[model samples]
Target: MTDAPDRPNGGSSRGLWILIYCLLVPAVVVPLLVPLYDKAGPTLFGFPFYYWFQFALIIGAAILTLSAYVVSTKADARERAARLERRDRR
Candidate 1:
């Protein structure tokens, strides 16, 4: 009753969501991890563990988010190419 290529797009669009989840790892990790760093055992440039940990989290979050963007962009580009190829074949 239905063609193979006409199947629903399920796994075909999973990359963006996977990328989003990857970035969310840091957001979730920081809140839970920060409590453990609420002491001054380590110091960076005179800042206590609490302060330096926040800075490191900021940088790490940024990197994770940037990587997510790149991954999603690549996924989108691949989708576009697939569409174009199907159109050409038709």
Candidate 2:
């Protein structure tokens, strides 16, 4: 057999990676789409929509990035454990 460790539920792990990408993509993409928040009306406490929305985006991005980080760490840990188990079997 190959040296590569067997991943139980490999498809699930692939899905998890896809989920991680989905979590991260909005954090990077939404803010770059400037026109989405380029507005002056609908102020929050005298802050324009453009300004407040940017702040909100910063918070949203932080949460999304944090979520991605947590998911990736767990996935990495699982893969590492599987690799160790496979090596031990040899």
Candidate 3:
């Protein structure tokens, strides 16, 4: 098929990134704007509930973003390898 090679590799791990972003955006934003309903702990660096929540969210987002990047790259590489293998076998 002449157009077969032109077709895009349909396996995109971007969904994971999107999911992470979706979770993270709200995690970071919600925490800052709205305080936690129930929690009693001494504030760190004199930061209030909202500030602390935002700080933790940012840290969590960073970790998730890193994980997503690694996983997506690995998946893309694997998919590329499989495609190449199929092409070679043909």
**Predicted structure with the largest lDDT when compared to the true one:** 2
lDDT of 1 by residue, 1-79 (tens): 7665631344355667677787778767775865688899689889988888878877887888788788878778767
lDDT of 2 at 44: 97
Error of 2 at 2 (Å): 13
Worst 10 residues of 2 by lDDT: 4-13
C-alpha lDDT score of every prediction, in listed order: 0.74, 0.84, 0.62
Candidate RMSDs in Å, in order, are: 4.0, 2.9, 5.9
- lDDT tens readout by residue for model 3, 5-54: 33235545456456656655654565465445235456777876555766
Question: Compared to the true structure, candidate 1 yields what TM-score?
Answer: 0.68
Candidate 2 lDDT at 88 equals: 87
Model 2 C-alpha lDDT per residue in residues 1-90, reported as the tens digit of each score: 797546653523566788899999999999899988898999999999999999999999999999999999878877777767768888
Better of 2 and 3 by TM-score: 2
Instruction: Rank candidates, lDDT, best first.
Output: 2, 1, 3
Misplaced by over 4 Å in model 3 are 1-42
Specify the highest-TM-score model's number: 2
Among all windows of 10 consecutive residues in model 1, the one with the lowest summed lDDT is 4-13
